[model samples]
Target: MTDAQLSPLRAEVREFLRAEIDSGAFTPDVDSWMTGFDPTFSRRLGERGWLGMTMPTDYGGRGRTPVERFVVTEEMLAHGAPVAAHWIADRQMAPGILSNGTEQQRRRYIPGISAGTVYFAIGMSEPDAGSDLAGVRTRATDNGDSWTISGTKVWTTGAHIAHAMVLLARTDGTPDDRQQGLSQFVVDLPHPDIEIRPIRSIDGQAHFNEVVFHDAVVDSSALLGRRGHGWQQVMSELAFERSGPERYLSTLPLLRAWSDHLREHGATPNQRVTLGRLTAQAWALRQMSRQVARELSDGGKPDVFAAMVKDLGSTFEGDLVTAIRDASGIVPRREGGTHLERLLAQSVLHTPAFTLRGGTNEILRGIVARGLGIR
Candidate 1:
């Protein structure tokens, strides 16, 4: 569907967010997850049938298309809603399962996910491997009925609060095989052998955690797909990763809030032009993202196109923060005008991860280049 077609749903999501704001479900002057974790907010969203709106209705999802999902997500981020508590679970893991999981897996997991009864974290980035997912040395040894896993994953977002993790480990052969030996498993994180230690970020938030898996036993059923096919599975998942409106829309609420504040104070023509240009760029990026969602819904992988969206989306995200700071004359500190202060603090603290998370800007450009047959 076109952006024009998505307008009605966007309006509906905006109304939903307005109610959340009125009820004080989110703070107007705090970083999304910095203050603390809030499960009640997630339950509220789930109860509204908004949590897994993209999954099939048989599994407790609303069965909406990705375009509709995009509208909900975009509105949430644009309003600066504190979705980080269930962010990785909903955005990455749940979608991954809905796309690639078996019927049993879906029946077992998706309903709980939709009900906010189960939460998941991603176990992809490790201490030694960061973005080089192929270099992940975490090993999972098969024991006929289950796999015994042992390794450390850094930057495992919200591991402490998560019940399970979609973990990637070397399973089949050797690391030299690159894509051949890797596999993805859904390991229960609250087990006795699994350890989770919070890693305090510069923002003074412990949302990120270092997870250690020592003899962490996972059932054979925990394998997300066929063993030794993790590279392919993760690649497909990245299409979901990069295609979402979150890639570019996370900071939109702050930008708009700042813009409104500046206009109320009688901004100059230059400031007005800057805001207009930024808003226009954001709108264009949103359209590109919606196109990728359409492609996904049509049963085609838009890998190349999704890469382009992420590359441009993240660049625009950083640029949006910069423009807002410049135009609104706000400093990146904890104290400023009340709303501007919160936005500046959030933009300052979270902007650094924009180019690095999901996939790095460098990696995305390479994907685009390869798609053009230039690499």
Candidate 2:
């Protein structure tokens, strides 16, 4: 689709975000984007038909292309809206389910997801198996038509508020092999056998959780794709996860706010040079990320290039936050109700997680190096 086709939707979303900002639904002072979590905000976006624009129409989706969805997502992040509540479900689970789920699964789960009535958490990274996908030991035992699962998942974002979890586990681990017996399951978070405890970050936000699944029974319908396909499924999902604007743009509001502050205060010579450099870097990264999105929309696996974007984008994020703080020569306020103070505080706390989440920067660089035959 042409850029023109995406512009109108982008404008429409911008208007909606402006309205939300005007109504005091959220404060623009902080990275209003990442600091808040409101189900109502999500449901409002859903009601506007902006939540699941890429899914099919039958399951409460709008049947738009990835590019269309990209326009909506980019706009939401740029406005610094509190989209974390529905971000995972919209970005990864919905697409993964649609790609690998049965018709019944889709019919049962996706409509609520599209409507923003349902939420999901990812149960991938465990306490012992942070970056190692092949090391997950969550056990899913076969019990005729259903399965019983038991394990712990750490750093699970929104588990306390999520309706379900797209989990990875070992269904049939044998002594000879580990990857041979992997699977993905949709475990209901509110089930009696499950527990979710908030793991507050350094910023004093309980955005992450330690989730324990004990004998959580799921029917056969909960299985996604096929048995022993977790490796391929997780890889496919990461393509969508890593290639998005979220990687670099999560900190956009902070950068923009800093830029605005610099402009309003009359930029000095040093400030002018720093601003130009940061602007160029942000612009180039944005273009690179969009290219990866184009590849994803074309149904091509942009794994190698996507890894590059994630690695570089993460570095850019850490560096940007540091540079803005250093160049401005201003202490990030911790007490003010203004947007700049909140942005500074939130960035100081949340920026470290950027390199750790999705995939660690080290892992991403390894993939890129291998793809270049540099190993």
Candidate 3:
């Protein structure tokens, strides 16, 4: 896992991305993992055994190292390839299923996930709670052999197209119970009683959605992990979500665009200095992210470490956008602009979300403070 073994695979992925780009499959984009959803490309990766890069062969995964998977994802984000379709499922869902899913659940979901045929949406945030699980009011009423879910989930990315969702519900307690009485479920999508509506972001993307469960019923087998262990299960999954390269590399394609512009149009000395500073910060964030991945591979609960990476990485992402915007002096246009201008437009609009998803910067700081015994 620690060998320079990543080199060959990295080269292979780069070649594939090059070919895809050369063939005009997609335009390079900033934050492509979130905004550039192409299921066909995702299935292409699955065919190459790149989607579930770390799961075991038993689950139809490649059994590669987490660091190795990180290498692949890093390349994808850097290229601005369309990866949104499988990003959530491959990054968190696969690992979450492996960590807490039953054998039956694993058999049913993992193979499809690795094949990029199945997609999942995270049903964590609510209109009131945002990403705060403590404010959750979604209730799953137990109906003997079945559970009836009735509630609303907001900011649910890709719910409109997902096959299922990993959701938390209040199964046995009131709001005062906080962490207790919360349970997780794997509810299938497109059910008659379940409704989904898109929420357009400032960038005019409709990937996020509001999902309403109106007494949607699922069998007892829908439960994930232990009963009333939703908090623990979700916390475990965040280790994968918050520490990845996507946290920082969302703006890299834009930076690359800026770099291209500078190379073609020339830059002042100050602009060169700015580029150097940004690259330095990007490298530092990459190192911290890699360390978190290594710690996870070694079976350590690096929750605080992950929080630090996420917080800093998101800051870097925003900073990268600002630096590029100032240096390029290109008026952003969502449509009919030069390549750099268009990339700048998207990256500019996406900055607000950098510190919001995967837990806000405020929440991440709280995690670090508590984990470090900072009183």
Candidate 4:
């Protein structure tokens, strides 16, 4: 959608957020995408037709373009709205399923996903496989009527609460084969054979999980796309996942809070300059992200470009936090602190994960290098 077309929708979302905040329904939070999970808020967004704006109309979406979705997503992040409950399902899983799932799978999952009633978590990262996803040791064996999946996944965000997970397992290859013979499965969660344990962060939140599947049996029909195509499917999905407003907006709430604090307390000339520089960087990155979204809408992968955007956007996220903290001259406190102080504390705790999640900067750099034939 063009800027003129998007203006009204943007205004509509901003107004909705204003009303929600004015009523004290939810507090604006730093890293709200990851830590601020509110199912009620997610359902509210779905009711407004904001959760699955890009999906086809037949599948309960608004049949909007990615650009329209981009407007709503950035606005939500900017306002620090709690979107964690439906973030994963709406952002990538639904798209993935639509692109690579069977008709039965699509009919079964898409409606609930668009309605914001179903949630999903990624099952790619393992204890030993962080950036090297091809090295995952999770194995799935065919059992005629069902697939017996066995292994553990670590650093799984929201797995404990997710209704299902898009699990990647080695169905026909060894670790030596890297990406070959891998497959994806839609595994329902909270089953008797699956165990979920919390991995607490420095902030004492259990958003991340360690999930173990001990012969977890899922229907044979749960396989997504084609067997041995899981790597390719996941790569396509990451292009969608890594190149969004979320990459740069994770610390936006903190940035806005600090900006307000400066406005109230007065900032020095140097502080103003630093804030301007950060704002410019964020604007440029947003343009880059929007370009990627447009590309996805046009059926283009733009993987390398996506990786580059993610690398730079994540770096900027960390830099934004540091710059805001340095300029504000307020020490972050975990308790009994001002809003700015609390947001700063939250930002500091989340800084390290900024570059790590959705593929590390180190891995992203490699992707860019290979794409440019630099390596």
Better of 1 and 4 by TM-score: 4
Query: Candidate 4's residue-wise lDDT over 81-148, tens digit each?
Result: 99999999999999999999998888888888888899999999999989899999999999999899
Query: Quick one: ranking by lDDT, best first?
Result: 4, 3, 2, 1
Candidate 4 residue runs with Cα over 4 Å from true position: none
Residues 1-375, model 3: lDDT tens digits: 654878898999999999999999988999898878899999999999998888999999998888999989999999999999998999999899898999999999999899998999999999989867877999998888999999999989899989999998899888799999999999988899999999999977899999999899999899999888998888888989999999999999988888888898899998999999999999999999999989988888788899999999999999898887887678999899798888888888989999999999999999999999998
Candidate with the larger lDDT of 1 and 4: 4
For model 1, give the 10-residue run with minimal summed lDDT. Answer: 28-37
Q: Pick the candidate with the highest lDDT.
A: 4
Q: State TM-scores per candidate.
A: 0.94, 0.96, 0.98, 0.99
Which residue runs does candidate 2 get wrong by more than 4 Å?
29-35, 174-178
Model 3 Cα RMSD, Å? 1.0
Cα lDDT tens digits for candidate 1, 271-350: 88998999899889988998898888888889899989999998888888888787777766666557667777778788
User: In model 3, which regions exceed 4 Å deviation?
Assistant: none
Ranking by TM-score: 4, 3, 2, 1
lDDT of each: 0.81, 0.83, 0.91, 0.93
Query: Which is the winner by lDDT between candidate 1 and candidate 2?
Result: 2
**Model 2 worst lDDT window (10 residues):** 27-36
Q: Highest TM-score among the candidates is held by which one?
A: 4
